[model samples]
Target: MSTLPQIEPTGATGEVAELLAEVKKNMGAVPNLVKVMAGSPALLKGWLALSGALSDGVLAPAIRERLAIATAEFNSCEYCLSAHTYVAAKVAKVEATELEAARDAKSADPRAAALLALSDAIIRGHGKVDRTVLADARTAGVTDGEIIEIVGNLALNILTNYLNNVADTDNEWPLVKPRTHS
Candidate 1:
C-alpha cells in the first residue's frame, strides 16, 4: 500500500485533472508515480515540465533510460526500476543485455559506459564525483553539454526514486526489483 494516496484520474479535478489528462494522452495511461505526484499539482507540473525538457536534450533516449535504471537500482526504488525498465525496452528499444548492464552502471558502448560510471559515482558520492571519472567521461567523448544533461537526468531520476521509495508507491508496470538494497 502507498503511504500517499494515489489520486485516481476519475476523481481528480482542476489542475490535477488537466495534468492527469496530459499524462494519459502522452503515455496512454497515467502511471502511479504521476497519480501520487498529483497530490501536489505543483510537483506534478514540475516533473512534467522537466521530463518534457529533458526529452529534447542532448542525451539520447536510451542513455536517459539507462541513467534512470542505474539510479533506480542504486536507490533501491522498485517502482522506478520497473517503470524505467519497461520504457527502456518498449520505447527506447534498448537491448536486453544493455538493460541488464545498466543496473550495474555499465555498458558495452565506451561512451555509454563512461556516462554510467559517472552516474554511479555521482550517486555513491552524493554529487562529489572524483575528477578521474569526469576526465574518463570526457575521454570517452562525453561533451560538456552531455555532462550537464547527465546531471539533469540524474536529478530527475533521483527525485522519482526518492519519492517512490518514500511513498512505497505501487508499481503498475512489470516489476523489476533491485539486485541489492542499501
Candidate 2:
C-alpha cells in the first residue's frame, strides 16, 4: 500500500512536548496537525503561532473560516477540508450546511456571492478574477484591502493543507458532525 511522505524528526525530546504544552495553554488541545508537525517543535510552533495570529486577526470569524474552507475544498485536500470545516462549525459557530454549500459553491451567501467567490479565484489564480470579477466583487461588498487579505488567507490554507496532506496526519481526534463525508 502507498503511504504519504513525511519529514521524520532527527531527534525530538522534551522540547517538543513543551511546545505542545504551550500550545495547549491557549487551546484546550493541540490539533493533530500540530502534533505530527511537532516532529520539529520549531516548525510546529511557527505554524501554530502564525495560524493563531491569523485566526485571531481583525478579520471576522465567519469570513476567515469562509476563506479557509473554500481554499481547502478547492485544493481537494480532504484532510484540510474536514479540519477547517469542523473549526468553522465549532469555533466560529458557522452553520454546517452553509459551510458545506459554500465549500462546494463559488458564492456561499448569494448576496455576497460575488465577493465570496474571490477565495476560489485566488486558489485557481489571479487570472480567474478579471476586471469584470473585480467589479462584481466590489459590487458584492469586497474592498481592495479585503481582496489582498483574501489572498493571504488562501495562501495560508495552501501551506497548511499541503503540509497536512503530506503528513497524512492521523485523525487523532474526532471531527465535527458528519465526519465521514468527502
Candidate 3:
C-alpha cells in the first residue's frame, strides 16, 4: 500500500504518457517510484532530466549505484534500497559483498570508500561536512569534479529516497530491507 497513488502507464495521457513511455523504453518497465512521481509530471520530468545528465557524469555507473544504495540505507527507504540493489547487482554487476558494504557507506576500493564516507558525512551533517572529510576524499584521489558529481548523485538519490519514504511506495523490485532506521 502506498500513501500516494501509483499512476498506471496504461492510463497516462499527454505529457505523463510520453514520460512514462520514455521511462519504459529506457528501463523496460515503469518503476513504482516513477509511476508515483508521475502524479506530478513536472517532478517526473525533472527526475528524468537529472538522471539523464548524471548518466554522462564522470562517476561510473557502479559508483553511482553504490551511492544510491548507501543513501537509501541511511534514509531507511526500502523502495530505493530494493530498486538500487537490483540495478547494482543485475545491471552494474556489483558484487554481493560490495552491495552489503555500500549499505554501511563502505567499499573495498579506497577511492569508492572515500566517496561513501563523504556521502555519509554529508547526509549525517546535512551538507555541512567537516574539513577532514573533504581532505580524506582528496587524499584518496577524488578530484573536485568527482566531489561535485558525488554531491549531485547524493542529491538525486536523496530525492528518490525521501519521496519513497513519504509515499511509502511499494517495492516492485526484489526486496532489500534497510538494516536500520534513520
lDDT of 1 by residue, 18-116 (tens): 999999999899999999999999999999999999999999999999999999999899999999999999999999999999999999999899899
**Could you tell me which 10 consecutive residues in candidate 3 have the lowest summed lDDT?**
110-119
The superposed Cα distance between candidate 3 and the true structure at residue 75, in angstroms, equals: 0.2
Residues forming the 10-long window of minimal summed lDDT in candidate 2? 1-10
Give per-model CA RMSD: 0.8, 4.3, 0.7
Q: Mind giving the per-residue lDDT tens digits that candidate 2 earns over 102-151?
A: 67544456643554576766567643667777787788777787777777
Would you list the C-alpha lDDT of every candidate in the order shown? 0.93, 0.67, 0.93
* Candidates ranked by lDDT: 3, 1, 2
Model 3's alpha-carbon lDDT is 0.93
Off by over 4 Å in 3: none
Error of 3 at 170 (Å): 1.4
Give the lDDT of residue 4 in candidate 1: 97
Candidate 1 residue runs with Cα over 4 Å from true position: none
Which TM-score value belongs to model 1? 0.97
